[model samples]
Target: MTQQTFIITGAFLGMLAIILGAFGAHALKKLLSVEQLKSFETGVKYQMYHAIVLLLLGFNYTFSTSTMYWCFTIGILLFSFSIYGLVISDAKGKKLKVLGPITPIGGLLFVIGWANIIINAL
Candidate 1:
């Protein structure tokens, strides 16, 4: 993706993180257990962190790469979104077991994304 695309995606993800964080704090608080709420918050935090990184990469083209962009983008989707799914569904009494595995795969992507930066710097 281009720098513009990264910027836009980052903005969108950041915006969504805020919205979800609010929703989790307000609406979900009553519906979820303490552990579930904590897990949801973790997703929001990771999403926001990567969203900021994406914005940085977008602004500084020298630091941006296709692999890095894809890794973060897809990682957020898989990791954060999976946690959201797991927590929400578990709250509703039917947790999706499949998403459990997907979360780590997403985390692996995040690790790879960061590793890419370190490797490129060296």
Candidate 2:
């Protein structure tokens, strides 16, 4: 993807994180248990964190690459969205067990993304 794509995706993801965070803090607070809420917050936090990284990479071409871009982009989708699915579904009384495994896979992508950054820096 081009730099603009990364920036736009990052901005969009950041916007979503804010919206989801507020939703969890208010609407979900009454619906989800403490553990569930915390899990949801973790998703929001990781989404926002990587979103900012994406934006930074977009602006600074020196450190950006297609591999890194895809790693973070796909990572955010898998990691954050999976957690959201699991938490919300569980709260509604139908836990999606399949999503439980997906969270870690997403996390693995995140680790790979970070590793890519380190390897590129070296």
Which ten-residue region of model 1 has the weakest summed lDDT? Answer: 56-65
Clashing pairs in 1: none
lDDT of 2 by residue, 20-122 (tens): 9999999999999999999999999999999999999889867888888888888899999999999999999999989888888888988888898899899
The global C-alpha lDDT for each of the candidates, from Candidate 1 onward, is 0.97, 0.92
TM-score of every prediction relative to native? 0.98, 0.97
Residue lDDT tens for model 1, 39-68? 999999999999999999899878789999
Instruction: lDDT for model 1, please.
Output: 0.97
Best candidate, lDDT-wise?
1
Candidate 2, superposed: residue stretches over 4 Å from native: none
Q: After superposition, how far is residue 34 of candidate 2 from its true place, in Å?
A: 0.6
Which residue pairs in model 2 clash with each other? none
